[model samples]
Target: MDLSEIKGRIREKSNIVDVMAEYIRLQKVGKRYRAICPFHQDTKPSLYIDPEKEMFHCFGCGAGGDVFNFIMLIERLDFMGAMKLLAERAGITIGDIEHKKGD
Candidate 1:
């Protein structure tokens, strides 16, 4: 599949809380999950994860995004690499997509 298709699959299969919990400990807070920001030296919980939105944001470091973006930042991966990683984690296979000359 193409990048957009892969991204959609990743988002549908990967839960924000589940993926984030794999990297850090998370505590339920109201309608979201809270944890210390891994992108910075956070002494207090500054990362908030919204499962409903499938997104995360750090109040301390200003880092935020969906599951793919989170993985890209945390794992230091490019877009394709992040997609492959999350696809593997979600047991979703991404078939090779032929890119156009300009793409």
Candidate 2:
């Protein structure tokens, strides 16, 4: 499959909360989940996760994005690297990708 197709499959199979819970603790708050931001030093729980939207946002550090972007930042990896890892986590096989610098 092409790269975009592979990414779409990975996203389809991934549960944002389930995937993030593997890295950090999440507390349910009404309709959303709240957690401390792992991207920066935080005094309180600033990251809010909306499972319905499949998105996360940190008020303190201004870090916000979907699941793939979260993986990119937290793992200190580029887009392709995050995609590969996410695919593996979701049990989606990805074909070989030519990863080069400044991607």
Candidate 3:
């Protein structure tokens, strides 16, 4: 499979709410959730996460994107690093497996 396909699968498998919850306290609001924006000095719950949409947006800092983008920003990691981390969390294997399996 292509790397993009794997990335898409990882994104789909990894829940945005669950990932954000691991880093910050999320309060349930209606069908969505809210939290203090980590990107800026936020006293209020500026960070809003919509689990149904699998996306997040921070009204304070204007930070918004999918789970991968969130991980990159919050974790202070590069795109590939975030991808690797999320891939492991989602139980998605990376690199060659068929060759290694035979060995």
lDDT (tens digit, per residue) of candidate 3 on 1-103: 6666777789888999999999999999999999999999999999999999999999988999999999999999998899889999989887742332322
TM-score of 2: 0.89
Cα lDDT of model 2 by residue, 33-98, tens digit: 999999999878999999999999999999989889999998989988999899988888787754
Please provide TM-scores, in order, for all candidate models, with all chains considered together.
0.91, 0.89, 0.89
Model 1 lDDT at residue 9: 79
Q: Which one wins on TM-score?
A: 1
Residue 39 in candidate 3, Cα distance off native in Å: 1.0
What is residue 97's positional error in candidate 1, in angstroms? 2.1
Error of 2 at 68 (Å): 0.7
lDDT of 1 at 12: 93
* lDDT, residue 83, candidate 2: 91
1-103: candidate 1 lDDT, tens digit per residue: 5666667778899998999899999999899999989999999999999999988999998999998889999999998899889889889888886554544
lDDT of each: 0.88, 0.89, 0.89
Candidate 2 residue 15 Cα shift, in angstroms, is 0.8
RMSD of 2: 3.3
